[model samples]
Target: MDFKYDVIVIGAGHAGCEAAVAAANLGSKTCLITMDMNKVAQMSCNPAVGGIAKGQIVREIDALGGYMGLITDKTAIQFRLLNRSKGPAMWSPRAQCDRNKFIWAWREVLENTPNLSIWQDTVKEIIVENGEIIGLTTFWDVTFYAKCVVITAGTFLNGLMHVGKTQLPGGRMAEPPSLQLTESIVKNGIRSGRMKTGTPVRIDGRSVDFELMSTQDGENDFHKFSFMNDGTQHLKQLQCWTCYTNEEVHQVLREGLAESPLFNGQIQSIGPRYCPSIETKIVTFPDKEQHQLFLEPEGETTQELYLNGFSSSLPLEIQIAALKKIPAFRNLEIYRPGYAIEYDFFDPTQLKHSLESKVIKNLFFAGQVNGTTGYEEAGGQGLIAGINAHINCHGGEPFVLARDEAYIGVLIDDLVTKGVDEPYRMFTSRAEYRILLRMDDADMRLTEKAWKLGLVKEDRYELMKSKREAIKRIIEFTKDYSIKTALINDALEFLGTTPMKYGCKLIDLINRPQITIDNIANYVPAFKQMLDEIEENRKEEIIEAAEIQIKYQGYIERERMIANKLARLETIKIRGKFDYDSIHSLSTEARQKLIKVDPETIAQASRIPGVSPSDINVLLVLSGR
Candidate 1:
């Protein structure tokens, strides 16, 4: 049988799901092919979504009309805003979700999406004709044709799972690996390498002693990810527990070193540095007495608990023995032992900024296939790839984000510019223009762009515009409104700040480190009256945004100026057909790297590792800049 689609997305993980949705939403006939329909958007590692930089990516995904944030909000069992005490730029919103519900939510959305369809089949080979992707052939000998293809195979391409000396051919724990796809792609001249990631053991929570652990609850206030007010609120929140692994636990785990695949040199790929296995942590930090472990609930309705921070590839017997040493886990009943899986990942440097393959026309890669570790990173890449695929197919201009614009931009830039030697993970520190790319205002930054691209819905777009106008009004009011000395002195004294002798604009008071809009609203009748006039639903968002804008006015302006200056380099486009090999004036290393990456702009070229300042100057001269 033959199936035809404008876009074909392989693998129904986070990346594939977003890619399919984005393409379909843009009116492209998209087919999402996965090995197992039941595992669509499955949380293979953890039940929770968003953390630190990952949380920011989720918001950006939502801002750009992606479904991840909305689905997460609908199924989230607990929500927390991380780094709230710090600056607004550092603030990130995270949600611990009901794993089953999260996947079902995604499935429901995809099923209802107008131009999208789901198929259960294992892809065997990408059908390339005349150096361009034309379609794919599945293992069952069924063929599907498409103008563009997105491969988000994740950790399933030639996957190998290890637990002690025992090894199995599996994508994750029980899922079968994609054996033929990686070989076919590699044979087609696309470079590939191996990287590993692991998941912790699942414990029967009913058997564990809660009294022996410290409880950590979610925030009391209501918060969500989608900007459109999805009406899905977390009515009853679940609490996570914390425990620690002592010297005894470490010693028992060390005893299994001889049989461990990681230590035995049976598994040789580099894993994530930030999320190290328990054995790696012990070996790396020998001086530490104990390591903290978070006992996360897999779902509110299930008794399974995800033992986070205890990811391992050790012997099953040793794992059980070590768990018996911890106080809270003394009577632990594990649902399954932890294991590490190593799989094929292409070097992301082979892709363009839009995630399209530089070697293969109409082929794109996202998620773990591109060497990124988190669901948020994968979803972000998937969205871009899907949009670009649709645009390319329909004769529209390709969409790309700048470094100063969004975290998604930083992620792609880092990958294509500097190739990863290990599993790549997003961090707030990675983005230089994070001050301007805060999670609080992602909708303001990307919704208009998404709307213009036909991705954002009209209702969501309208909400975003209204919110932006409200924030602007509040900021302008603060700039013009002044509080009298008599009215503000008591509030200032209460806040432990020196009382002002004269009247001052509200913006001036807001600029002070200790003062906030909420604080001023409590004492000033005029300010309170203005706030009262605004709708209750929008008041909190307006005040929060207004406060950040006022407090960091100078820093934000400086960053914008720097961003604008760097953005000029992006305007200098590099011709696609330009022959770098013919440019003899360029250095040998620069020529080789530039030829390999074939960067789209002077800004991107400048970021390439071996391309020096001298090389950039030569390019400028060659381009007659």
Candidate 2:
């Protein structure tokens, strides 16, 4: 077989899948190499996708023509719109997926993608000559040449799995570690560190006592992650069960502290802080009496169930003993025991905004290998890396998403600017312009740009244009249409809100927190007629988008103004190879950080942890800003 390619993506997890598809779809010949092709896009930690800020990233990925949302919508077993009680900016979509089906869907998409090939093999070392990536060598000693290489190795580099005192050399439960690649990269001047993450034990569903737990059913109203189709409508919904761990269970786990891998120093690396293990939660919050655990099904055909929020690395006997203490798990039968895995990750500060390694040209790193966690974060980086790898190979300008434009941008910026000491996960709080980057408006924010960059197809781009036009028409209709106060008094009174004193613009009424388009549509005949005139398929989204735009008009405008102000800083370019040490007026810490990160823009330099406002002023003056 021919071994030459434009891009070689190492790994087939979420990052690798997106990266391969992106490059191939952009007309570059791409090859995805993995140890096990059957496990492509494996939900290593959870059989789910999208949550909080993560949902926004997924939506953004979909908007950019990435396959994650499409595949997720097709395989999801349950769906819910989180934070519905909150404003539109806070609302996020999350899905509980059928794990096996999710992987199958990804494999099918990859196999069918044009110019993309799948190879079942482990990448042993990256081949680089001088300062640029040339290709990679597999374990079988076969060398494949490529112009660029995207490494999404995930938790396989020098991986070490821990369960109590027993240690194993594996990336996951059954997969072996990638030692040679890790060693080669380190020797190539790429700084690396260790990170720890754990997964919950799988239990047999037949042994679970559902009567003792509360049933958490899926949303009755269908909501999908992908904007391209209505695939979520046809899936069979599944229910999850919730139970609590009392002080008794905690005491049992405490007894196993002597043998626990986390406490016994068998695993010293940091795990995800937000999704801590049950043992860590118990010890960290000792005053709390109980912690909630969610039982999620792995798949429809399989009897295996995931014990969410109960991730642990204690001895198997102790885990069973603790499980027996819980009323709902008295007869629990284990499918597999939970274990913690420590893997090598490179410092993201060593990379540019395009996710390309500064140490080596045409070499990119994404996903867990960049010291970040979560499927969405990995997919976002992979998409960017894949797109940029193609761009770099074809002599095109690097494609980058600004911090104001996407959560993906915020994630990458944070990683490259501040540098992570622990495993970093995305949260809504991380993005200052989240109001402008809402999940509902991701397509409006990114589709046009992606289309210009050749990532989005013409059909999807046309759909996005039509959707935006529909939203515009709806917003204008709301502003121009006026409703009589007397006619709407009854509905307003029914809602327990103050009635309008005179004829008010429909948009003005919508600006009230208590008043919604649906509520107004019932009373205003003209508004209901206007909604009917809109295309039936486009009605729901148009109404929702119009409401958000009208209701939060002021806040959205303010955020845009702030973003515009910050845009100037980004326009002031800082040469990637500029000598920061020559700026004698800069602080010592700022000089060190600037030299280390070599930020490409003044705005990026300002975001670095050690660079102060004074340092930014110095940079601005030096750059003639």
Candidate 3:
């Protein structure tokens, strides 16, 4: 059998779903091929979405007209803004999703989308001709032709799961591994490496002693992921419980560490440094006598609880022994044993900013296939790759987000510039301009760009424009209106804020650390009425933007100037064939690495590990920029 499509996206996980939708929504004849249609967008590890820097990626995806935020909002059982007490830059939106519902919603959305088709089959080999990827052949001997191919085959490329000494050739639990794709890519000269990740054992919620552990609940004031569901009601949330491990738990793990796959050479791939498993953490941080274990509810209806921060690949008997030592899990019934899985991922440095392979034209990669870890990171990258693939096929300029512009920009830039050795996880610290990339204004910053490229709908663009106008009006109102001590003295004193010595604009007063726009709205009925009419997301957005403007005005402007300077460097484009070896002024290491990577921009070149400021200055002098 033979089929033709404009774009072919392999694997229907978060990355593949976003890629397919992005391409299809852009009017490409896109086909999503997955091994199991029933497991499309499956949350293989965790059932939660967004946290810290990852939340910003989700917001960026929403702004780019991707469906993740919408599906997350639709299926979320609980929502909260993490780091609420911190600055606006640190505040990130997170949600606990019903896993089954999340995947179902994804399938429903994909099925309803125009120009997108779903195929239930495993991709066996990529068909490349003259170093250009043309299509792929499935295991069943079906050949599908495409102008561009995106591989988001997350954790399924020769995937192998390990539980102590027992090993299975599966992607997750029961899913079969793709047999020949890894070999096919290697034959094409694309470099690949092994990476391992693990998930924690789940316990039946009915067997756990919730009374003995502290309950972790969502905030009283809820915040959903999508701008579309700001005011709508979602499902009622289930509570999560927290417990801690004592010395006995550590002892049990230590006694069995000799048999662990991660430590005993059964697995050689590097795992994520931030989200280490129980055995790794115990061995690495031995000074800490206890580790916290969270019992997160899998769904509102299911009695299964996800054991967060307890990921392990130790023997089953040892896992049981360790759990029995925990205060709240003395009589815990085991549901599933945690295991580690190793899979093949490409070296993302081989890809251009468009995520298209430099070695193979029209071939792209996303998700864990590119060595990224989180659902949001994969989704964000997939959306970019999908959009760019569609654009490339149309003879349009590639969509590239810069470091200072958005978190997605930072993510891609970092991946292409400085390739990660371990599973790459997003954190706010990774972005130098996190203040400018606030979650509050993701749509404001990126939607217009996406809309102009025909990725976002007209109505969504209009909504973003309207939001900008409202935010402008609110900022002007606060700037123009002054509050006299005579009017606000009592309320201010009652709230323990310093009473105004002289009259000041309400906006200026709101810049105070303790004061907020919401606090003053209650004092003025007109302010309350004005806000009540706006969309809740937009309202929060306006308030947050106002607060940031007032508080970090100088810092933001300084960063903007710095970004502007860096943008000038980005304007000077270089080819991948630039012979850095010919530049005698550069250091030997810098010259060698530059010759090997062949960075496209001076900005990217400067970010290479061994490249120095003097070398960049030499490049500027040589390029006459």
Candidate 4:
């Protein structure tokens, strides 16, 4: 089939789906080509969307008109806000999904997308001419010509699965590897390196004894991932069972260690160190007597349950025998044995900040191909790449989010600037301005930007604007309203807070560490009445954000100041072809790395590994700043 499209996206994983949708929604005639159409948005590893810093990225994606958060909310079977005990910056919304439903929902959404067309085929080679991407060629000798091509192949490029000495050429379980595409890209001068990831086995949920495990239920009030999704339909939730690995399981793994693919040199790629396999955990922490195993339901109606923490690649019989030793898994029937997959990923240093390749213009890479892990991280990159690709196609400015603005910014900035040696995962610590990038205010921070790009719906933008106005009115009310001492004292006593000595404005009182908007409402009827006047959801969010602002006021303001100072450096642009090697004041290593990477901004150049603060100052002086 010889055809032309405005944008062609390779792979139908989280990254590809988002890329296709984003570009198509932005008015491009987009085509998504995947090896298996059935595996669109497949949760190859786990049946969960958001966790820790990853949740914030999903929320950011939603705020910027991406479909991930909406799909996650629609198909989630259970919802919980992880790290709630910590500050709002640390609180992350996570949802346990019905694996089958999630993928189906993604397909349904894509089918409904106006400008997107889905084709089932392997993209064998990306076509380039005069150093710019033209499109791709499929394995069946079909040509797809497009202005831009996004490769979100996600561990499918010459994928190899390892189980002890036994290895197979495939992506996931039954899907065949894209052998020709790997060679094609390599021959085109795009560098690739190996990385490994693993998933746990699936067991018969009915066969496991529930009495021997602890039940992990959803939170009392479910948290929705999308700002657009109300909590009306999130009523029913499934439960996850927790079991433990005793000494017996470890000993069995230890005995089989010599034959393990990871230990026996059968696999060379580095897996995610944070989400280590059971074998790695046992070997790394020998003093540990036991490890927790979460047996989560794969779907509401299905008997298959994923063994969350028992990921391994030992022989089939050894895996079964060891699994039986776990308290709740005594009668477990393995649906599949856990194994590690090693695949090719490119060094992100080769790509520009827009996720477009420096060498191959109009060509972009996202997800595992960039050496990152997690569905949320992959989706985040895909959204950016798609947005930038759309911008590039339109001859408009690229949609770039700074580190201080959104978690998506932190994710991409880290990838382009620092680059990754191991599989990169987002964390709260990685973001320098987490205070400004909280999940609650994602829409407030990004909807306007998205709206200007014609990516966000007008009605949604109007809703966001109205919410902003309502929040401002509530803040004004709190600033003007005052309460008497006796009533305030009564509320304070009830909340274990010391009574205030003088009458104060509701906002001033709210700024007190112990006096939340709810506390003020319990005391002063006026404050409560003021809240009731606004929309119910708007009321709660304003209160929450305002309270956080009051409590962390000093720290937040300080961080904002620091961000603004850093923003000044970003204004000092280093042209794409600036010769850092000839700059005398810079160190030899910094010069070498700068010549290799050719970062777009001084801020980005400062973040590169070999660059020092003094070298940045030297560059600023040399640039006549």
What CA RMSD would you report for each candidate?
A: 1.4, 1.4, 1.5, 1.4
> Which ten-residue region of model 4 has the weakest summed lDDT?
227-236
Which digits, one per residue and each the tens of the lDDT, describe model 4 over residues 461-490?
998898788777767887788767976677
Could you tell me the C-alpha RMSD of candidate 4 in Å? 1.4
Per-residue C-alpha lDDT of model 3 across residues 354-385, encoded as one tens digit per residue = 99999999999999999999999999999999
Tens digits of per-residue lDDT for model 2, 147-219: 9999999999999988888899998999899879988888889999999999989999999889999999888
Per-residue lDDT, model 2, residue 231, is 32
Q: List the residue pairs that clash in candidate 4.
A: none
State, as a TM-score between 0 and 1, how close model 4 is to the true structure: 0.98
Model 1 vs truth, CA RMSD: 1.4
Give the per-residue Cα lDDT of candidate 1 at 263.
89
Off by over 4 Å in 2: 231-234, 576-578
Q: TM-score for model 3?
A: 0.97
lDDT of 1 by residue, 1-625 (tens): 9999999999999999999999999999999999998888999998988989899899999999998999888888888999989988998989889998888899999899999999999999999888899999998999999999999999999999999889999998889999899988988899999999999899999889999999988985645787775444663589999989999999998888888888899999999999999999999999999999999888878999999899999989999999999988788888999999999999999998889998899999999999999899999999999999999899877899999989999999999988898999999999999899998889989999999999998998988887888888888888898788987898899998889988988888888888888887888777788888866776777678778888888899999999999888899999484799998889999999998888888989999999999999998887888
**Which candidate, 1 or 2, has the higher lDDT?**
1
Taking the candidates one at a time, how many backbone clashes does each contain? 0, 0, 0, 0
TM-score of the candidate numbered 2? 0.98
Q: Let me know the TM-score candidate 1 reaches against the reference structure.
A: 0.98
